[model samples]
Target: MKLPLAARVQEAGAALAAEASRFSGYGWMRGTSGNLSIVLDRDPLVLAVTASGLDKSELTDRDVVLIDADGEALDSDDPRPPSAEAGLHAHIAARTGAGAVFHVHAFDAVVAGHRWPGGVEIRDMEMLKGIGHRANDETVTIPVIANDQDMRVEAARFDEVYVAATAEVPEVPALIVANHGMYAWGADVAAARRHLEITEWLLRFAVATR
Candidate 1:
């Protein structure tokens, strides 16, 4: 359904806030650890993203800041700033055409990303089907990039890795950065949430099995 820009902003603001809170409750975003973003529209380069340092569990729609495509803060009543990972979010949307980007540091993803050595591959799991992969018979390779303190550098590294991973497994929907967190995206918000949920489940399973 088409919505006015203000309504769209509010809708995206609420959805992102709720998603952040849910992830917090799941222990993925504990201690203000994760960030989320949704595209308001492509043309004007508007995005609604979580403000930095806010406790995810109590995040409000007021905490979601609107930023331009280049990551500049747009004029808004909410004076809070976007998260440090704003660059990462913008990079993903630009590179992947993703409508929503969700990042979290669940124990499963952190442990798996660290222990998996080269990269984590999920094979022969029913949950693998959730990320739009064709079959469980094949391995969905999730590249685990080393985390960088400088997000700009990290974003560039992720861009390269994302391109390579997509080239390798075009259907794969997410990637993990070693010792950092996991990123999942999709054509829209609901699809992105499913991808994140399924990937987290698969990562937990892989870690538990090994």
Candidate 2:
């Protein structure tokens, strides 16, 4: 049976907190610079996003706030506001049907975005398989979109560059924001975390080699 919404929300919050803490420990979410979210419902598109301005490393299950498809906070007694990038998370979830989305300010991601403003391309690397790409004879571009303070503008920019996956090629499942950071998503929290890590590793390799 499906769990109650409240129960599901609590579970999502805990899962998000765990992932946030892991990323924070890696210094990817330094201070409150990054945000994470998980879909609590798909039909109405409810999400549990990390609260704004809190130390991600210290977050508990209660540290998240519920938001709708538009990133508007739902009616709740919780006084915390959702992350400023909650809308982008909502946009990604809506566009990709990803169950979880994570944004991080990893140094490598920023460097790679600046180095490859058009997009970061990877090919013939074993790590590529980590992101659903072939380990050889295939090149994939992780799209890079211009960053904007306005979430609407950012989402619009993403729409222009976003490419759907095809039968012959799997989507990279991540993108970089030029001069900003990276956003990675997947079917669930675990997959999102793996994509995030693998993409960051790939970026680090690209930056290091260049």
Q: Which one wins on lDDT?
A: 2
Error of 2 at 60 (Å): 0.2
Q: What does candidate 1's lDDT look like per residue over 93-172, in tens digits?
A: 87788899999998899899899857798778877778877565687777788887677787778766664335446756
lDDT of 2 by residue, 71-136 (tens): 989967777888889999999999999999999999999999998999989888999989998899
Per-residue error for 96 in candidate 2, Å, reads 0.4
Candidate models: Cα lDDT each: 0.83, 0.91
Worst 10 contiguous positions by lDDT, candidate 1: 163-172
Clashes of 2: 0
Identify the runs in model 1 with alpha carbons over 4 angstroms from their true place: 76-78, 164-168
Best by the TM-score measure: 2
